[model samples]
Target: MEKKNNRYSLLLVGLAVLLVVGLVFTVGRSKKPTLNVYNWSEYLPAEIITAFEKEFGVKVNYDTYSSNEEMLAKLSTGATGYDIVVPSDYAVSIMIHQDLALPLDKEALPNLANIDPRFLDLYFDPGNVYSVPYLWGTLGIAYNKTKVEEPVTSWEILWDPKYKGRIVVVDDMREIIGMALQTLGKSRNSTDPAELMAAKAKLATLVPAIKAFDSDNPKGHLLSGEAWLGVLWSGDAALAGMENPDITYVLPEEGGGLWMENLVIPKGSRNPELAHEFINFILRPEVSAKLAEAFPHGNPNQAAHALIDPEILNNPASYPPAEALEKAEWLIDVGEATVLYDQIWTEIKGGR
Candidate 1:
């Protein structure tokens, strides 16, 4: 009987050990890894997020900002734990200057070779050290065919007296100011205080002609017949055209603001390895093709072009002719000159 008791005690101890091990295994399996992504609104597709989560067995915390300045302001307030951020070309320059991002590990990004060489080595990110091109777009004019009834070749049309109270411009200071500067035959990236003031004055003149300053869904106003003319991003105009055939987009004769958005791994990313994995996944031709199909923006992934439908690839709203591209210019970081521009903008907008 004593020997039987001893065997029973040994079995009980073994059972307790197995129970502990099983509990630990269950807890570990329940705690999945996660990634944080901060990007533009509606830029990334929902299916991509779900696919990545299923394939990697990780959760994604995706957040979006309407503009680069808004993203910068949030980061400036000490926001942290962001694994990835998408910034426009000029914003990339600002982030690089502030040392807010990490150098990419090219070894982990084998699909980086799929990006078109034309989109690489841009002025804001030379050598492509800190950024990778995501998409390219132009700031142009979108107008209703029945309302305008004139050749939309110049930025001057936005200031036409007849378009008074019928025009919509983006709330983005850079895009609106750039249009004014270009219309005056100045550089799209003009940093001179006098030029900026001049542009501001010209924009002030256009205030009477403007109906609303919209950033999100300016196309909505166009579709509703509330706005006949608008300064819009190429992708927004293309999206508008898809809904209504009469919505036409045109590049200004002076030049339009050409821009590119890039993906960067912000500093303090807890999951750097996962961040690299996500970028590599995005660079895959099939994934890029999916993004192109969802958004009408110009896809910088050359390898994905063949995978994309020819109709989308040939759409002039998304991909204009080479000559029109030549007339376009990029906005750049103006260093200390941003203060002057901001001051002018504040004065024009009646900002307190």
Candidate 2:
């Protein structure tokens, strides 16, 4: 009886040791951190994410949204666990004002020096204390050469009755209104109620002509011949031109809005250090060049310029002339005026 009891006790002890060992191993394996990133649709190359994961052993949970408002709304709820987000210059300003973004730790991002000085210390996050410039481009017209005989030089072409049902505009409130404001020789960031009303009136004329309002893939409309002319980001226009030689991107004579998308850590980041590591990794010259090659936007990293493909570097659409940039205006945060914008945009879309 004593021998049998000893065997039973020994077996129980062995099982307990095995269970503790299993728990320890499981906990150790689960300790690997995850970095959640929220960015624009089709913004980052897949390989970059893979490379970062392999190098840091940190899993990347990347999610994409089509607009700044969508990203802002998600983060504002404070329910999401996004560690990083990309927002446009004006949106960055809004985030800063709302305390939705966290200040960047420059010490962790030593590669920030690769960014061009011209893109730094701008109206949004002056001194770049809270954000890093990722990609930049202009809002302009992209037209199919075979579909339209007229030279597309101005925003007025989008409102021409002849092109009715063949034009596509981005489904963004600020961009569409900004274009109208530009056409009227006003600031894209104009807050005057009278100016906004005038812009809204001008946009009303385009209602009948717009075939579809798309922000995700306006290039698809242009590629399929469903849209002869489109208001598009320069990078999207560049991609369309590459896919179909008939597509051509042109800056309107009246000038257009210039925007810079930025990388920022939100206020509730779960892995702030990891976020900084990822930002530094992306700012590397080689990595930034790869991004420029994949997205074909205006490369803000001066060091990446030498490594960029000549075809992309020389593309006038991707890198507009100095004069065009000089005339361009960055969209600034409009604060409470945003409510007015929202009302007008809703009215326009509702055909009110």
Candidate 3:
């Protein structure tokens, strides 16, 4: 009886030991740090994240969004836990204003010098406090030359009777309205309620001509010949031109919209130091050059520019002429006036 009792006791002790060991193992694995990043779809080079993970001994959880508003809605919910995000210049301002961004620790980012000072301290995030500029480009029309009778040099061509039912523009409200405003000799960032109304009225006229308002893949329509002309970003234009040589990108004579993409750390970042490290890694000359090769946008890194082919820099559609650069205006947030912007945009898009 005594021996049997001892065996039972020994078995119970062994079970407790095994349970403790299992808990320890699980805890160690769970403690391994990770970072969560949310960025625009098709924005980053493929292997940049992989390289970052390997170099830092950290795991990266990456995701993508189609538009700045989509990202804002998700981030505002406070459950996504995204540590790093990339938004355009105006979106960065909105994010900063809404307290969605965390102040960047400059010491962690040694490569900030690689970015052009000219791009820095713009109306958005002055002194580069909350964000770092990523890629810069203009909005323009890309069309299939074989299908288009003449080169499209004006935003009005998007509404031409000949191209009706064969045009796609970005789904962004600001961009669509800005295109009309520029065509009408108004500023892209005009805060005047009257000018916005005029822009809205002009856009309403072009609504029937649009096949679709697609921000994600407008180039697909042009490439597939479903739509011969599109209001497309320079990167998408570059991709379409590569897919078929018959495609051509044209910057409007009226000075189309200009924008900058930026990298920012979210307020609740679990790994701010790691996020900064990754940002610096992306800013590296060789790294930025590789990104430009894959994405084909105007990289703001001077060192990267030196590495890329001169022809890419010389591409008029991507870089634009010196005079156009001087005339272009950067977008800024109008604060409480967004309600007006939204109302006009909704009215135009919802009319038909």
Model number with the top lDDT: 2
Writing each residue's lDDT as its tens digit, candidate 2 over 1-352 gives 9999999999999999999999999987887899999999889999999999999998999999987888989888875889989999989988998899999899999999999999999998889999999999998999999988888888988878888999988888888999999999999899999999999999998888999999888999999999999999899999999999899988888888799999999998989999999999999999999999999899899999999989999887799998878888888878889899999999998898
In candidate 2, how many Å is residue 309 off? 1.1
Q: List per-prediction Cα lDDT, in the order shown.
A: 0.90, 0.91, 0.85
* lDDT for each residue of candidate 3 in 235-330, tens digit (9 for 90 to 100): 888878877988888778888778899999998888888889888999899989888877778888987898987777776667777677676667
User: Which candidate order results from sorting by lDDT in descending order?
Assistant: 2, 1, 3
Instruction: Please write out the lDDT profile of model 1 over residues 207-291, one tens digit for every residue.
Output: 8788899988899989999999999999999999989989988888898979999999998889989999999999999999999
Which parts of model 3 are misplaced by more than 4 Å?
1-31, 309-311
Worst lDDT run of 10 residues, candidate 1, spans 343-352
Q: Report lDDT (Cα) of residue 264, candidate 1.
A: 97
- Candidate 1 stretches with Cα past 4 Å from truth are 1-31
